[model samples]
Target: MIRKIIHIDMDAFYASVEQLDFPELKGKPIAVGGGGDRGVVAAASYEARKFGVRSAMSGVLARKNCPELIFVKPRFQRYKEISQQIRTIFYEYTDYVEPLSLDEAFLDVTQNKMGNPSATLIAEEIRNKIWNQTQLTASAGISINKFLAKIASDFNKPNGQKTIKPAEILPFLESLEIKKFFGIGKKTADKMYHLGIFTGSDLKSKSQDFLEKHFGRSGLDYYHIVRGIHNSPVRPNRTIKSIGTERTFEENLSSEIFILEKLEYIVEDLSFRLKKQNVAGKTITLKIKYSDFVQQTRSHTVPYYLSDKELLLDIARNLLFQSKLKESVRLIGVSVSNLNSDQKKKPIAVQLRFDF
Candidate 1:
């Protein structure tokens, strides 16, 4: 039995939401984030993307890429509200929905409540419902498994759908560029190119042992995914492993006094997140990124759970002063792990008939 998975991804979610709410922003290149020298692009509208503006790019560079790009502060609360509304539409079709983030998810509608057999039609209907309710467009991909579905979803993006029938899977995978595989990043792709693995067919030609020798444990994943074999199921209830927050400064700090000042706000933000989730952790970790891009972390575990801002700040301060400053620091982060929440039970996978 084969599973029918549909991957639904909202088109430039944050930027799109901004454009939807502000008519003036429509048909323009816009970025959703701070516009200052220290600011980072959280998301870029389609128009901005064409000019090489992208999420995580520095605002300075984004501006250089497209000077006319308008920057808007992010409204996370509003995005969450809209995300929830979109999720409700998904639940109407299937219960096996695994959310990747606020704007994308995977749904196993092999046995949908609507008694619908065609995952493609269900995807189309779901996209339609989202547009009708939120005035937002979503792209979807339907295939026999999550890996294929996820890649297919991006084939025709920003209000489009694609279906990869079982018979077409092998040919599609063979023709796909190695870099286009979901988990293969630039560095990995470069390494693969050096190894003559330029396409999925090239990747599929390598033996598991050869791949493992070169790429270690991840090599096995590459071998299987290249052949369109991904067995990971759609887990609807993913565990919250940690709650944290971080800030990158426009200017690096050289003194402990200035670093501590930044830690105060970082700890406060982490506390708010932990409290919002009604979860606390016994371990607190501090992350430091130097101006040169070198990173380090210091963690301390307490006997009792902690979520209060004062307590987190105390731990963060200790972690910070635990060692002398290596160099000018560019970013600082605080995270709490080892939460007290109960682990969710794993659902048993059911073999279902595929109609795609």
Candidate 2:
């Protein structure tokens, strides 16, 4: 039987909430983030987006794009509260819900609580309920699997929804831009363009062997996705195996001081997240990716769980020095695993954002 999957994405979640709560901010260009020179934009209102302002862009750059852009500090607590309200509406339909982030999730409605049979109606109802309860709009995409549903949701965004019936999958995918396909980042897309694969149809022309030869294992994924085939299930009650953050610098860093500075930020973010979740782990893993794209990970397991920021930084520092760097470092990451059972079962999404 065909599965029914729906991807729900709150429209400009943080920015939208700001608008809804403060009518003065509505229809204006605004960004949710620190307004400092070193701070980054967490979210940008649609008005700000027109001027090329985007999330993760530096606040200074965002301001240059739209001098009128209003920067507001993030209110994670309020956002979390609203996220719960939205999740409650999702549960009214199905237990098989997978939250990708506080602002987006995937719901499996093939066998739902309402037994509605129609994923379209379920998405519609859920969006309606979210708007009614929170005065915020959401975009939804419905299809046979997670990938297509996620892509579809972005098609007509902001209070819009779309469904890709099984028969329509091929043509729909064939017309999509290669860059828009999930898992294909800007770097990958540039490579695809150079290979003359600009769209789904272009990608579909390559054989499995050809794709695998070019993209390694991920080539197989591209081959199937371009043909509208994704079998990954909507996993519910999914345990977060690990929580981590990583950054790829524009210029490779050879200086130890610079590397340690970056590690400090990564450790701070991880520590705050662990505290928010009220969880800790005994294992600390440090990952480094070189300028040549060679990746390596080193892990240390302590006797007791640790969540202290300073302690994590110390461990990361030791791991960094103990390992020999083959080349200049391009990216670095820190993760904690072997979490407590309570944290593993905790129903919350931990989002990892990486800029290419």
Candidate 1 ranges beyond 4 A from true positions: 243-283, 286-297, 300-321, 324-355
User: How do the residues 1-356 of candidate 2 rate in per-residue lDDT, one tens digit apiece?
Assistant: 57888999999999999998899999999998766755567789999999999976777899999999999977767888899899999999977789876789998887778968788998999999999999999999998888999999999987899999988999988988999998899889999999999999999999999999999999999989888788887776677667887888879999999998788777866775665455688899999999999999999999998888889989999999986788999999999998873643655433221110
Model 2 TM-score relative to the real fold = 0.85
Query: Can you give the TM-score per candidate against the true fold?
Result: 0.80, 0.85
**Candidate 1: TM-score?**
0.80
After superposing candidate 2, which stretches have Cα over 4 Å from the reference?
A: 260-282, 292-294, 300-326, 340-356
In angstroms, the error of model 2 at 242 is 1.3
> Judged by lDDT against the true structure, how good is candidate 1?
0.88
Look at candidate 1 and tell me the lDDT of residue 16.
96
lDDT value, residue 319 of candidate 1: 93
